[model samples]
Target: MTKVVFITGASSGIGKAIAEYLVEKKYKVYGTSRNPDKVKDISFPLLALDVLNTESIKIAISTLIDREGRIDVLINNAGKGITGPIEDTPTEEMKSNFDTNFFGPIEVIKAVLPYMRKQKSGKIINVTSIAGYMGLPYRGIYSASKGALELITEAISMEVKSFGVDVVSVAPGDFSTNIAAGRYHTPVYENSAYKDSYAENLALMDEHVDHGEDPMVMAKAIHHIITSKKTKIHYKVGGFMEKFSVVLKRILPDRVYEKLLMNHYKL
Candidate 1:
């Protein structure tokens, strides 16, 4: 029997790449997009899903289960980036960021856990970011959201171990994707005291993301995680420096690591 795979944010970028690759690998793939009509060009089934909407998630998952009978893999890849200084970004904006980036994935995971638990086998992969490990200057909210997801992934991995369910967080460093186009630029930045640095750093960050590695790199890492018999709780994928930075955070002193990030961002 073909293994059933479901992925979120499959309309474009990393999610799209992963869904496409898995289809090529001959896995029964079902992907989600908020606007299914918009993603009609994709090869696989693009179910309408707004991760922030509880009903939307439940319906999408139910639809998939009705067709496939079981979901072997669940990829929580739906996310959006929100950029601005911590002080300048509005509270509501931060909530929106967490709604999609953090709470969204949690809901999907909750919906799939029961199915996986009963089957005694499943793989859950959450796509996080390198910023989750360290609080970036202007992208604080985005980092916090990813950081929150990272911890959830870790905690759930332990909780679900007995059920034979594997939960992993895949932190991708700057990947060239359409994330910037969808990024929420808090208007508060225009009137804040940190406006200058915010603009400079935001622009620099966008440049780096635009020049980042191909989304296929991320897709490959996820494929490995799905197929491997024993996978780590966290996997970092990107350029060497990006992966090394995570290691530095673990071994370096707070001040030293802080200085390094500050210098790297030219802050």
Candidate 2:
């Protein structure tokens, strides 16, 4: 039987790339866009789903299950980017980011687990970030949200293992995506304590995204994970240094690792 794969946030970026790739590989692919009606020129089904809404998540999953009868794999790719100093960024904005990146994925996972458990097999891939492994300056909230999801992936995997529903996370480094455009950025205040550094880092972050690796790299990595017989708890796809930074964090002392990040950001 052909595998049925569902992806969230599939209107563009990594989600769209994975959906398109899987479609070419002969999988039944259903992807979600917040405004599916507005998205044109698509080859696969793009359903309307807003990650922040639980009802929307339930509807989208049920809709896919209705058509396919089974959802073999789910790519939890829906997320929001938040950037700014931790102090300056509104608490509401931080909460909103967590809603999309952390809580939202959890809800989606919750909806899928029962079906997957009944089927006795499933794969889940949560799209995380390299920055999530370490708190980056200016990108702290974004890092924290994704980082929380990354850890959650591990715990969920263990719980779902006996049921045959495998869960994992893909932490991509700097992928060239429209994320920067959509990012919620706290204003650079004229008299804020971290004004100059925050402003400079904001520009640098955008530049990194612009020069980041292609999203197709992530697409291919995910495809491999889906086809594999056994899955790991976490898989990271990005440039060497980006992946290495995670290792550095593990080996380096706290202050040393902090210094490295500060130096890189020129803080």
lDDT agreement with native, every candidate: 0.92, 0.93
Model 2 poorest 10 in a row by lDDT: 227-236
lDDT of 2: 0.93
After superposition, candidate 1 runs with Cα above 4 Å error:
188-191
Model 1: colliding residue pairs: none
Instruction: Give lDDT tens digits, candidate 2, residues 1-267.
Output: 999998999999989999999999999999999999998778899989998889999999999988889999999999989988888999999999999999999999999999999999999999999889999889888999999999999899999999988899999999999989889989999989999999999889999999999999999999999999987888989999999999999999999999999899998
The Cα error of candidate 1 at residue 98, in Å, is 0.9
88 Cα displacement, candidate 2 (Å): 0.7
Candidate 1 contains a number of clashing pairs equal to 0
TM-score of each: 0.97, 0.99
